[model samples]
Target chain A: MFDPEAIERIRAKQRAWEARELREFLARQPESRADCRTGSGLPVERVYTPADIAATSFDEIGLPGRYPFTRGPYPTMYRGRLWTMRQIAGYGTGSDTNQRFRYLIEQGQTGLSVDFDMPTLMGYDSDDPRSLGEVGREGVAVDTLDDVEALFDGIDLEHISVSMTINPTAWILLAMYVALAQARGNDLGRLSGTCQTDILKEYIAQKEWIFPIRPSLRLVRDMIVYCADHLARYNPINISGYHISEAGATSVQEVAFTMANAIAYVEEVTRAGVDVDRFAPRLAFYFVAQADFFEEVAKFRAARRIWAKLMKERFAAARPESMRLRFHCQTAALTLTKAQPMNNIVRTALQALSAVLGGAQSLHTNGLDEAYAIPSELAMKLALRTQQIIADETRVPNVVDPLGGSYYVEALTNRVEAEVGEILKKVDALGGTVKAIEEGFFQREIADSAFEFARRKASGAEPVIGVNKFVEPPEPNAVPVHKVDPEVEARQIGHLRAVRAKRDGTRVAALLDRLAREAADPGVNLMPVTIELVKARASLGEIVGRLRQVWGRYVETPVF
Target chain B: MPPIRVLIAKVGLDGHDRGAKVVARGLRDAGMDVVYTGLHRTPEEVVAAAVQEDVDVLGISLLSGAHMTLIPRVLELLRAADAGDMLLVIGGVIPDEDVPALLALGAADVVLQDTPPDAIARRVRELVAARQPR
Candidate 1:
């Protein structure tokens, strides 16, 4: 924020410079197009000056690590510590994925982000009738505690943080993780990892709902409370906008919708009698960093500012950590092109840089071949190299907020903050997130954006490098694809059967009955009971199915 | 010409229906009768739906690499049901190496991920026109 005297001088000088400098330039170059816009279709001005940021004040754009942290979340951001190079990975059976996890850790990846296959993600066991042909294709298949144990078999759970990209059955997977840690004698208080326990986003974009909205919110609240009490070093919930963006939301909607979901979570937890600062400090977010470098950077800055102000004023938070918005970001997988798959490497690197510049706390750079298959080992290594290149080679992370004082970035930050605020208000006005979700509000908005982007790409208004332009036919020299073994399904099913045959049937039945009873009651926290069942050797399907009997499966109305 | 009746379905446990829903809308925009069999459908349910809807074209979308295992099953069921003539088109996150195997399993075409909505519409029309009764 500049003083008024300097602002007046800068404004007058900018006008004169524009008049004299633009008169000569406009005659020759004139603007190439009638309008220039960001990915969200927000207008981009020809020039920005100090006058553009004249309205902001010092308090609004406070110093990094201070209240309403506009510049960056922490004062010495990357200087104090490097962003976690967490690569998202998983494939095949448990042992297979464990090797990949260990491989990444050896390649200097700081964190492990787990990806679950469709059956696991949908809250069903591998042997479920509906899970045919999809046991471990997209991600690793976890049917029971045995599978979870094998997935992290040799990998030390304490040394590295694990982030499971599972929802719908997030609570179950988390319970299994806690149980496994306890069985391994790791202190439950020191279990460090993130379970993407964001169920609201599932109903909104991902469409992996196992129960209706209210029950789903209850599960999220239960996890938040349980983690707050038990898992001090763990992040119980990661209110996410990554899937929302992948589902077709623009940057603004992604922020607003994600924040609105966060508010709902805050309300539920606080009303459950958990204090504001109790769980809010550990609350984390997941976002997709699209290709637009400046827009994406501005979105991150604006997100921190908006969240801080909202927490301090609305929820009456008592701590700075509770006010600060910490988040993890990934390069946009939706923007990856399958045409010339190699181009994705460059795209991913650029997006990763944008995230780094935007002050992301942790980041995942998508593999180049992700659009084709689960990233091959070679592709995953290259993805990790991209992060290393950005952090170690580029000198990009040397400063806290190098672009903080720029005219364009600051003005764009304010603009994005205002836009996100407007969308959040709309979500609240529609009787909050759950009411809006039932009405298909978020779904419709995202579908519209997805369609618009698709149409733009189809028409060449938006020229994707290899998709609609400079296209090439399928070549022989393709990225070596990783295929889930054809026998993985049968072997996984056999393993499940063996686990079932060996476990004490009576104890399993009793634990499941108790789980069902607890699930039926509205005043129960299902985490402790879910943990008990998981420890009792109850499978994912058994636990989920028991609750499913009590709270019926969710059948969503198709929005499109 | 009656609209080319199509059943757009997701078989297997792949929860990604964004592509399926978009293609369904695109086909509907092109004036085809599109019936979407929502998420978590089995191959048997998909086959039964195709037979019941009497769709001329059946577009099955899978992003989880289940096409290799699930496609043959759907094809086998259709043949047993005497509906082998139905056009079995596929799309979504498919690898080029598996395209031939899927085609050998009786797929009509592998629609590219970013194909235009009208191109899908046109292809469905052309496929039906070729199979029309004399």
Candidate 2:
């Protein structure tokens, strides 16, 4: 923010300097490329000056911990407490992932994030025919509370924050988590973690939906209300742009689509008579720290500013906490190359640096071998060490929003905010998120962007180190990938069958019937009933299947 | 002649369909007719769709590490249905060690992540051309 006179003088000097100094320099050494753009295809100028951010107001880029927190969410930020190094770890059975959890925690990780197998994520039992050959492969497979208990066996429920990367059956997992905590005599209010309960994103980009849009929103609302009332310290929903970005959305689309989904969720919860402030404070976000260093930083800043304004103006949220936009960022997995896999470590480091400078509250630095499979133990440790080095060795986080005053960053932040606003306007014009999703608006937009990126990479316009530019001979089996035990599926299914045999069959049936009945009534919150069912050892598939009878499954009209 | 018909299918629980969608668009842009069978389709469903669509190439994208189990099943179903003539291309985050196994199981080609869509399209064309009785 500069005075008009000063800005005018700066613009005049820039022109004069460009006419003489830049002309001579450019004549001697012409620019490399005529068209230079960021990863999102935004134009990047030769240089940024004070005139670039002249239009931005000082208050718009306010101090940390203040309203419209473009700088950072908290005042001290990393200076007060380093971001939670929550590396996601899940594979094989529950005990198998539990070992990884203990290993990561012992390796100085501050938080725990679980990655469920397809069965658990899609609300299928490990033994379901659809879950055939998929059990405990991609991530851990949990059939009931017994599996969840084994998953978090030695981990302290109160001290450690757990984030579950489950969407469709997120409510069931939340219910299982609550039941686990109750059985362990842990205080629900003191329990802390996040369930990625953002269902609209599931429909938009992730394509992991069980129920139709309306009923999915209902489940999200129930989780928000249930967590707000009971688990005060827990984050009920992590509105994610990570999956959106990974699914080929540009940086702007990632923010716009996720915020649109966030708005829909807020409306759903608030319309159900819950106050915005009650649950808004616990509303968290997840984003990807992509390759474009400054753009990723600017995107984070712009996202915070937009969200603050939206909460205060649109939703009428009163509390400052409700206005703050806190997020967990994982280094972009799509950017990692399988060719020279070691190069991904450098990419992840730079991306992690961008995330920290952008003021992410929690971070998950992806492993180098992620392009192949889930990271091995050594790779996960390397990823965690990347965060540690950034926090302890690098003094970049010593200052709050270190890039806040940079003209380029501020100008880019303004640009991203404007672009996101335009997209949101289009969504609103299309009758909001659900309506837009129904029309395949988000899907088409993301697919087009993805296609464009693929075309660019194919043509060598965007050079990926090991892929396009610096070509390398194929090295077969160079990187040792972590393989899930082949017997894991059989073991998980046997455990599931054992759990079913042990639990009371009559009570489980009764709970499922009641859950289905309550699910039919739109007024009833499904969390309590779902919790009762999970407590009764009703499997995830049974609960979701019964509810599917009432609220039919969602079948998306395929959009490429 | 007619445009190359390719059916890009995601035959598993993995929802990472960006690769599949990009490849589909690329194939379409490369003057091919591409049909995507959405997400969460089983091997049986995928084989049925491939047979019904009668496409020259069927590209199955799987990222859930279930490729070993799922791809073999798809190959089995294709043989059972006498649709083994269709070019079965496997794509996604498939490991290098498993590539030979997948190829041995009758997969025409195994495309890993970061293969440009056009390259994938070209590969599909080459595979289909080789399969043709010229």
Candidate 3:
């Protein structure tokens, strides 16, 4: 990046300036902190000179679309085609969510990301007593093929791309999607979307896991094989770093831990007789765009480099696309404040910009009222408008990796990559992600980081403007939040009963029995068989229940 | 006597337990007894634990909008279980419109996400002050 002699001379001059000018200025006005660091607590130098990125050269940080693609993935990047504007949305019953999905598409949203309710997410049916109140509060409730069909009711499967944010029952929903597409006469090869089948992260962060580690990985493997053979365009698993960050991981930990899970998935798929290159290109990531602007940009760049290195060096991936780490980014929901609810609008816009500058393949800008309830229609429209404003008005996307050669960005990128590499080595030494998870490694780490952050906020050291620093009286009359109707749960249960009564109960039972038998045999790909069961009106709970007989439930180890 | 026994339990299927855990840790650090039932506990199980533990206060955190159903059930269970005297403090992404209903359902306090940890401790202390003269 810089000549050796010039870097040496610059370092000497910087030291001289710090000794004289910095000391004199500091004597009059002391620095805010004794030292400055990035959001991840990595120490930052006062001034990043050529000396910092002295070893870097053009080949290492080459143009976009090249190997070790630290800058960007595509050649022209946003100039060629802007990143997909995919807003995550779902609530109430499937039919209710179907309306919301249709609205988003009409609003010019480029992609669709589905958020399932707790009952559906945990693989439970609407009628289960445990799922009594939680049928459709958080997201849409999908219990059978009928729900999935209703959810995607009027949407064109060929045009829109969907990302399902589910893990424990991801494979079941994927089967439902395939069945729905087949029933619609849509080409299975052309169904573009991603199923978040990454179960390891569920145990580490979100705590929504159903089966134990080994068996869950087995399900993930089976889905990968099925997707590779059938749906070439759809991603079987979105190895998520988003939950890790939301659960209190540092940016570097988010990258390292997520990539660790990706490696575990790759190892599983390969060990299941599939080649790494065959499935690696379809592997995608989901990350959080936190409040730190430059740090978020550098984190994405470093993640790409680390992923490329991992695929090429370790797995010996054959194709160039196999080494590319294509990912979807969501604005950090943790950064949104419940206080001054309108301020969240600004926070979301800033985070959305960070995601765009970071070159995310897809983006989901959270709604302003998300901290209170499901977003109101007005709020969702405003969020979509924020993305549109950035895409249309902003000229930042005209060039690729616009900040590729900055001293500060390059140094931070290297620092993040090196720290994430260290964490990966630690994960590797602990045997793998599975063993580390069993030992509560990731959970403990996230807890410690979370506690540290909470401590900082409590002490008023890290001042959040609307929360800790600026106090405000409650606004008695505030934003109108979208609420799930009380009738939604009852209606969903009634629909479930109707489906059960209308379908051949005896036939459904026999298909479930066959499903249970096939589930016991690890060699079977449950997608096709599950599709048959769903076609016969066998509900999600029934199939998952049969497998639960074999796989058993997962109880998380307490971290606090 | 002993510190104020508080059971911080997560009700229903919401997996975002970070707030509950943070409040539990803060309460524990404030010299109170805090027992977390981990994630996905039903209302019946929560009330049963409240009765069995004989906790002075039961703090149930819910973010998945299941509170309208779960909170009323827990209150009913507490009354049926003869544990109606227990104070219930609810927290997490609860809508402003739902606050009055939650309070009418016998919640001692409806704490929003923006409330500080120390404020939570102080509120709990004030709530239990009258009954602590044993």
DockQ top scorer = 2
Over the stretch A394-480, how does candidate 2's per-residue lDDT look in tens digits? 898799999998999999999999999999999999999999999999999998898888888889988899899888998877677
Question: Recovered native contacts in candidate 1, as a fraction?
Answer: 0.60
Question: How is the predicted docking of candidate 2 categorized under the CAPRI scheme?
Answer: high
Q: Give lDDT per model, in order.
A: 0.88, 0.92, 0.89
True contacts kept of each: 0.60, 0.94, 0.59
What CA RMSD would you report for each candidate? 1.6, 1.1, 1.5
TM-score head-to-head 2 vs 3, winner: 2
lDDT of 3 by residue, A225-324 (tens): 9999999999999999999999889898999999999999999888878899999989999999998888999999999999999999999998999999
> How many collisions per candidate?
0, 0, 0
Candidate 1 ranges with C-alpha deviation above 4 Å: none
Estimate the overall C-alpha local distance difference test score of candidate 1. Answer: 0.88
> Model 2, residue A365: what's the lDDT?
93
**DockQ, all models:** 0.68, 0.87, 0.68
Q: Please tell me which predicted candidate would have the highest lDDT against the true structure.
A: 2
Give me the overall lDDT of model 2: 0.92
